[model samples]
Target: MNAPRGTGPYVDAHHHVWDLSARDQDWLAGAALAPLRRNFTLADLAPEARAAGVGATVLVQTVTVADETPEFLALAADSDLVAGVVGRTDLTRPDVADTLARLRELPGGRRLVGIRHQVQGERDPEWLLRPDVRRGLAAVADAGLAHDLVVLPHQLPSCARAAADHPGLTFVLDHLGKPPIASGVLEPWASAVRALAARPNTVCKLSGMVTEADHAQWTVDDLRPYADTVLHAFGPERLMFGSDWPVSLLAAPYGAVLDAAELLTRSLGADAHAEVFAGTARRVYGLPGG
Candidate 1:
């Protein structure tokens, strides 16, 4: 069962935690990302989550390495704030199912609700549709887990096609396909979003938008068109909220991110507000006591 509907008690559908000593995050490169080069722990996030009324969260993958997922699952096992985890794995590997099974048997394994590959970083936009990747996605379905799409706008068509190819697996689209809100453009993105949402097997996370916008001067109005596009197309029930956390710190504080999401969804009415903020995450991730 999904979480109960309401105006509060939110579920953050996406966030990440990392320790540099634990493992190197090769993606945290460049001078612009200096703020995130340090370790971000659950201890650092707990108070922030509590302050924002984030009752639970889905800990997402930061790198393509296998060590990160088990590390995240172990973290989830010890913390109540993390209700589920979307970990990483080599989706193209022949023993992908065995790897998932091994992950499930790890310390924090039961909390493993989904799998995500950094498809956006892949040079090929059609990476998700590759036969090996599709077979791995099918194995994820056989294991009863959801798959997350962390692709860019240009890669969304392939994501949609992959979702169609693997009807039994639920595809969770992270960050609204990473829209170009900073540029105020919404074409190819909107149309591609519609294509992905057309599949019942797909859902989207209303996350990472603040970072995508002009961080220093972003307004809720600037974020509206993109949010409304997903809200109206996928509806609140198919969309879940995610803070993107320390990554969001590059743009706004945690509270500001939640405030912006609330502002955008104010017209969704009470029930829908609850679904977008918490219910959808609970349903899709199968968090316990939902």
Candidate 2:
């Protein structure tokens, strides 16, 4: 129940944890993602988060199974560090609302604040607009959960349209829609992201840039354009910070991620900095304790 207090107790709005023994993360298959193949429980994240002054965090889903969300809720119920869980459910399922209700009735169900899907993995850019998906999203909105968008650059248009159509739901864009930072190009991605942000319901996370860039040689300067674009598009209140955790381990350590975020957002004033680091997350994901 710890809240954001003083200049510390920052909220990390996005991170992930998985137990390989419990279940396999099919997404962590590639050689490039081999580093994340091992188990990463909250225990593994707690020290780094605490050292970084991260008092609360929203644990995001890595897989698209119904079982994973319940496991996440159970983990949240037990962890002092994890204050919220943004889990996954089959959004295309007709029983989405009922499934969501069942999730809420679980152990840490009260901590279920948001839902996410592997929208980036979908080949079709307009998947969010599908009738079944829209219905599921409405169910999530009715449940009062924010929807975390993890789509590619081309998917931004549909994200914007979905947000416009589902005004009752809040859209939290993850990883800046996986910007093309490694290529050092910002055209279509930048413009598309701006269009998505134009929707009042949309918010963006300043996360995953290190991995998005040339992982081995990425610099804070390399991430500036994307970060700046999001900063300008969403401003402080509409923008939040996320570590992207285990995935971030591929590019940089935990503290380094926070350091780069600090450097990228140095231009913002104290209040704005606070918002990006903590306040925005607390507000957007509705993380517990202020």
Candidate 3:
């Protein structure tokens, strides 16, 4: 299928670049994650992104380290392909507001459009509701930045609660809350996603599905149900397309990922297609010309 097109360059709302030499990505230690241990730089990603017709991309945080955000901001500052960054900071810190201020003051800091944490690894399902975390979330709202939720399905209830508690903050759900596509189960995850979508402040990214499914044999049909669920729940306006690249390479090439997203949303009309492929991301991230 042809890649999805819109009135403007498609905004890839989620993707990442990491240099293993600068710092080890401890998560890449497993044998299953071996393919990603090497360096993935913007230079490597830019040509492919360009070929995919992606004009602007949002660089998302991969690790929980505070230093990573500044480094990502610096990278965004220098790159034309990267128009925004969803970075990481210690949200539990008492001085999170000040930390956010300091981050914003850094080079390319204006490109810091959002914040994210490894909420998927947390033991406590209610981690988002913890007093310290909630305080930090409020600080994020005060700074006029969004929070990216990279959580597992079971933890989604807390996500809904957090969104309810912080109506001013936009919660961008990454990877459709990491649904169980490999097993073909969607009930609880779909229901939970709908509940979260009930909050007007929440948004969902149509990303990471290729990796979530049976990597070697998955098809666009396998991803359609989940995509349809979010499309119905959030509608095109609150939904966005994300390549989830490098990580997405585990299951399919960058172009194949884009192709699958295009196929899944092919049923929509021209305007809805534009919203899913470009418009939603631009507005949600507050990117240029949004």
Candidate 4:
């Protein structure tokens, strides 16, 4: 049998890069997000990732535009840093499977590991359970791609149900379902998370806490309870680290995000740390190299 995989290199399982000159990020129109209105490229992230010891990254989708996935795939094809991409496609369309197939035929198509929709923007909390959405999820599973869930706490039950319905598809919960860190409330979110974790096919990203918290006044202790809850619920094997990058810049710098993640998991043993920082992402995303 093969030996256990040691902590080879950290994998940033989630993050985003965008160019404003090419297209408008409608989400950035608000003044609160004005700081991120400027373009952020892989070039901007490379040094910060390297300094943080992150060797590979999964560049995630920002907008729901059809062209964005191909752009991300091409970016991954060109960059040594971006190992995989979780891109966007309209899940309600009848041609989604074909679209996924077409995307795989693009420049960096092979680097496409998963699909994501801005579920948080949906008015319906049970959007994932919609028949058309469920059909799209089946297509994603058939394509051997995971689905990234970027939903809020109340929507997590739908996430759990989606995971249950599509056992073949891996449901990666981004930002631990975006917990209420700022308010310091854990109840329904924690309970919903535990329920989702019980589904076995689900995974959670240990990222985005800083922004979820009161950006300026947040402390590690403030995040500890939530972190501990996921650690207990999903365990390190099902949890991966992410920087959330320039978006995370709203609250803290890249190094600080990585530092916080390191501190949060410091109590874990080396093997568990290996899983959270690297192995889980590698296995979950089918990323190449360490």
Candidate 5:
């Protein structure tokens, strides 16, 4: 084993923080994700992550509601470990640019580094290609923050088209298009992922894949193919490790997840390992301490 050094100073590119008391994450209350229905605060995450040596975290928005991002920004401001916020903004909104501007003025709004729309939940494979949606994404790019894509495997083609359309924007793909690892299918998902990775402006996050598999029976090896596919497609420089935190709890513990990623990258040269484990996230998200 490479036995890579500590996780401190590594930029955990994707994670989430939420409070059930503040608003209902209805999706989590459903059977598939009921375990995460309760509140998951920064305080709850910090200690567990700290044990893994994680210095800073990027708090991603879990809901599409307008208030969710602002709430996350406030949480980032209050927490020392939260170095950035990848908040959500309705890109299809007529005033997306203005909305992002407004977001910048909130408590930890200045920590805002990117915007993400839960395109995966929309279910329309071409959802990202809608003209108005593209316009909003363009605005997000035109503004300066990176655009994080959360989409399903079948949507990768449209995502590629969107990435091509907005070369000026930095695109971060969440969960490697969330390949169907549990079923052992790979062709289309693998091919599409490679195509998306071909875009110089795009990057991929190695996260959330466990839950996509058999959440109750997944093992590190079950996640290996998806991870291996993404590593080959995006390479170490464009790839980054993300814990996906509270949400990942449904499948594995934080430390175990971190260890899996570490083990996967063990054979890489020191510099390449650093890039995947930390460097890439720092540059892609403009994280501090780079």
Candidate 6:
């Protein structure tokens, strides 16, 4: 379907899709993300996405299980709007290189643009700097795939260090390192996000900030600092917009997230807006016909 004329070319670079009947989402079983316990398919997201001027999207993984990776690949194979996928893999596995190779052979594995681990859930702050993890990251780089860092503020430095260590791999930080937005604290997170952005290969995703803020009353102002800081750090060339979708539903609707992003960058020139809206995502994920 063609996007309406005179509007932006938008691509929600971060979103998720899941079917509970097909497989369990162990992470959403808890209270924090309990609202997303049910299935969220493309049909449920497309209308909101289209209303927001999104022409395509990158489907991210919700579960850490290896089995789910292939499932997502299959889903992408059957969905045209799913431009790319950031799938999960046990990076610590000694056979991680083999795993990546095998995954590339799967149906939509060719669309496997990046790899992500639920590192934010790990107790170790230095989990990313672990020797095994570093080796696995090298395998991802060697396989010519981007590595998406799903981490917290505390892990930003280690994440930065990892990016520095592996210059060959493209590092995309998830959710601006998930800043402490609810309390309005910006010191360490801002500093860390900038430091990470200093690495040429590292880019940041403008996603998940709403959930980090007070869910009930969060507004565009609440999301500005995080977005502004990242924009300054990575600049429009390396930054991209993402909905976080059902996860974002905890704080606001999908269209609201796009509106917040649109409002935040209103001052940016049209060229810059075009890049942030869709160009950066196309460059990062290697979107079709880009």
- Candidate with maximal TM-score: 3
What's model 5's overall lDDT?
Answer: 0.85
The true-structure Cα RMSD of candidate 2 reads 3.2
Q: What is the lDDT of residue 52 in candidate 4?
A: 71
* Residue range 177-280, candidate 4, lDDT tens digits: 99999999999999999999999999999999999999888888899999999999999999999888889999988988887887888888998999999989
> Estimated TM-score per prediction?
0.96, 0.96, 0.98, 0.96, 0.95, 0.95
Local distance difference test scores for all models: 0.90, 0.91, 0.93, 0.91, 0.85, 0.88
Measured over all alpha carbons after superposition, the RMSD of each candidate to the real structure, in angstroms, is 3.2, 3.2, 1.0, 3.9, 1.7, 2.7
Ranking by lDDT: 3, 4, 2, 1, 6, 5
Clashes of each: 0, 0, 0, 0, 1, 0
Tens-digit lDDT track of model 3 for 183-282: 9999899999999999999999999999999999998899999999999999999999999999999999998998899899888999998898889999
Write the residue-wise lDDT of candidate 2 on 26-114 in tens digits. 87877999899899988999999998899999999988776998988998999999999999999999999999999999999999999
- lDDT tens digits, residue span 151-219, model 6: 989899998899899999999998888999999999889998899999999998888888999999987
Compose the digit string of candidate 5's lDDT tens values, residues 33-83: 878888888888888888787888888888878888888888888888888
| Model 1 Cα lDDT, one tens digit per residue, 189-222 | 9999999999999999999999999988998889
Worst 10 residues of 2 by lDDT: 1-10
Candidate maximizing lDDT: 3
Q: Which stretches of candidate 4 lie over 4 Å from their true place?
A: 1-8
What ranges in model 6 sit over 4 Å off? 1-6, 30-32
Better of 3 and 4 by TM-score: 3
Give candidate 2's error at residue 207 in angstroms.
0.6
